[model samples]
Target: MRKRIGLLLGCLIIISIFTSISVSAMTAEEIIKKRDSNEYIKTAKAESEMTIVSGNRRITKTMVSYIEGDNGLTIFTNPRDRGTKFLKRDDDLWMFFPEAEDLVKISGHMLNQGMMGSDFSYQDMMESDKLTELYKFELIGEEKIEGRNCYVLEGIAIEGKKVSYYRRKSWVDKERFVGLKEELYAQSGRLLKAMKVNKVEEIEGRWYPMESVMEDKLRKGSRTEFVIKSIEFNPKIPAGTFTLENLK
Candidate 1:
């Protein structure tokens, strides 16, 4: 009886050690929070170019954007798309067309439609920083991407939560917390889109993706390359920049 009890105690100790190690490992939720915190700033200004490719055709548009918290305002600068404006306030998104002199509110099924014929949707523009609140995360494993070690994380939308992607898997750089690759899926388990970060640059002591490619799986031979021309973190954005009136 004494020998049996000692064996049981030894097994329990081994289990405890493994359990403690598991608990000490970084969690998926924590990693997501870190990435979000590192990416988002109180206020920022940026200039970017979006190049859309469809089969043999390619089009590029340039735009400038201002962001404050979850609210953002973007205006096209290229001659082809000049004066076009988009505003994202909380959960609402609106667009203004200079030529049509029309202001449109984007919601429901329209949110799923591509933005300016690009792979990005209007809903993708309204993504908030509070990822942990809307999704449950699981740390699947680690992998190497572009010569950098990354943590592989899978996220599922929480019940009753409305999100652009029902499921997502991301490869985030271990040290910089920047996402190197991401796969977005629909609720029915269909792959919708994939995003790859091609380059990263350090700006204002923070790591930011300088260029990224987004591919639409549902559309044959459709892809978009987004490049950040310049960005300023924590810049002082003028008041009313995110308001609907300013969208015009």
Candidate 2:
């Protein structure tokens, strides 16, 4: 009987180990929760240097942007550019163009257009929610990406969704749910662009993507790079931080 008891315990140990491995192989969405209820959401702030190139020429624009959670975003460029330059909330759409001096509401149909003629759309440039909220994630498998063992997850937008990426392929670190690189595909099944998050900085003991480069797979020789020079978290933002009246 004692020998049988030992054999039973051994079997249980092996089962536990197998269970652990199975959970480890789960998709990134299984690991992280949406930031909406999370108390510790990181905010991004800093000077932005954007370099745009269509062909042989390049245009550089310097701006400042602030992101509060998944909704509050303020992008300021060109001191003389009018409008609040602040987008505080996002429901079904978003608005504002600093240079245009007027606010234009985005239509659900226009969400597919290239933002500023670059690879990323206006929606792509904005803050994003956790994977589980916006995507139905699945671990397709693993592969070596840039010498890193990454879990390749495929995300499909939920049916009847208003605004979303049709299909996305993300390579996430086994240890970190945040993706190191991502590819967005259009609703028509065309590869729109490739986004590479090159550098990550540990600020205040939190990891943040410091440098992001996006290439337009559809438009040749066009790219945009986001460089974060400085970051301040949880600053005292005003209640009316982004009122339309300020645009005047």
Candidate 3:
């Protein structure tokens, strides 16, 4: 029965297509040039701290996160939890359990659900399925963040069929290639989620985000944060760090 359900979701994925936004027509060469010459590497590390604020109330926790471009996402807790980890590779995501020997892919309608029921959409944590590949680039504008000026970009899905978003906004810092802020929207053009960088620190010689926050505006008073104590980018992480060999 589970296999059948996976097959059905796969079918739905195949059938769902979105309209494409003309990213190629934009300044591809310039974007690549900027990315290549930039200090941001192919991979990066961030220590995250999440705080939940609602109704004059707030809660907080610390976490560690890593991003490997062209590879996928991995999130773990600080001070370590027994076998508690989340890994998402491509379209499939799995959670690891300390006692289990296999990683289990998460499905069901809640696949799009926010992580751990936070305000952030699952898509907010995952790379926009259409970004970098689908959207044309333009150095449309800039903003001041952390006392540094950032490039403001607008992304449109190229051949945007099968997308969860229509148009998106980003504030990318030129020095680090990290987005300081992001906003996502739906096809009907409704605001869906917002991500903000709250703190930054220099680890070793690299400057990286020390704390980050994600809030789901559509859901009242809902949000998540990733707080970090340390981050080592390009560390010798095991190749299997993202596998789902055990899920229990």
Candidate 4:
């Protein structure tokens, strides 16, 4: 009986050591990779609403967006902004004015401006690259956001990469691996924008943010609430949807 008890204790000790090793071996890159796997989609069609809030004033806009690889097209469908479109192909962005019947290319400093008077910039909407491609991430520590445990990570832009925010801090849910909050910063370490997730839903076996808010740090009492009404992942997209010709 004594020998049997000793052998059982030895087995339990070994199991505990192995479990601790596995947990401690998780790297920052692996964490980001898991997050990308859960959030990134090759193609998707989404209907969304954006509400811009400034002080006591609020304006809401409805839009339909198609995303495939690195290209995207968004069209406003609401009565007020009907027919307005934005197209992103490769590194270029173009906007269409339905009333003026004009197509304008967005570049330089204009890319940093708000998208349709919202807190989200044209550059923010155009972000299609994976976090791994644009930044080098380091595991900073762990924190709790909204009562959920999260893995804190800081990402600095990779050299020569053209990214709107030079640095970013993200709080990723430890269980679902979805980002709960993120802070965008300029090269000078000034906070540019902050995003917080209000709701998350399971869609097609993946966790997705259904509602979120983006706040412009430079603007006082201004924020944008973004809600995804519907989304279909890996949806069939018609050809020429991202072309400039389609923008007009």
> Could you arrange the candidates by lDDT from highest to lowest?
4, 1, 2, 3
- The C-alpha RMSD of each candidate to the native structure, in angstroms, is 5.6, 5.4, 17.3, 3.0
Instruction: Flag the better candidate by lDDT, 1 or 4.
Output: 4
State the weakest 10-residue window (summed lDDT) of model 2.
31-40
Give candidate 2 misplaced runs (Cα > 4 Å): 1-25, 31-44, 78-88, 92-101, 108-111, 126-128
Cα-based lDDT for every prediction: 0.90, 0.64, 0.62, 0.92
- Looking at model 4, report the run of 10 residues with the lowest lDDT sum: 19-28
lDDT of 3: 0.62
lDDT (tens digit, per residue) of candidate 3 on 1-248:
99999999988776553211233233533553454444354565656555666556775545555557544545445343434567767666666655555555676566678665566555555554335665655567667987987777877766735566677787777666656787877768888878788776656665565567777778786777766666667766556655555224
Clashes of each: 0, 0, 29, 0
Q: In candidate 4, residue 206 scores what lDDT?
A: 93
Q: Write the per-residue lDDT of candidate 2 for residues 1-248, one digit (tens) a residue.
A: 99999999999999999986886756456633421223135565666666667778776656666655654655656454323354645543355765565676655657667665555566664536655666777777777767766777788887876445688887765544446788888789998888887876666755666788888888888888877777777666655545555433
Q: Which parts of model 1 are misplaced by more than 4 Å?
A: 1-24
| lDDT of the structure predicted as candidate 1 | 0.90
Q: Which scores better on lDDT, 1 or 3? A: 1
Q: Estimate TM-scores for all models.
A: 0.88, 0.75, 0.68, 0.90
Top-TM-score candidate index? 4
State the lDDT of candidate 4 residue by residue for 1-248, as single tens digits. 99999999999999999976776688888898998888887899999999999999999999999999889899999999999999988889999999999999999899888999999988887786588889999989889999998989999999998878899999999899998999999999899899999999999999988999999999999999999999999998999899888888
Say which candidate scores most in lDDT. 4
What digit string (tens of lDDT, one per residue) describes model 1 on residues 107-204? 99998789999999887877777878888989888899989989899999999997888999999998999889999999999999999999999888
Q: Return the clash pairs for model 4, or none.
A: none
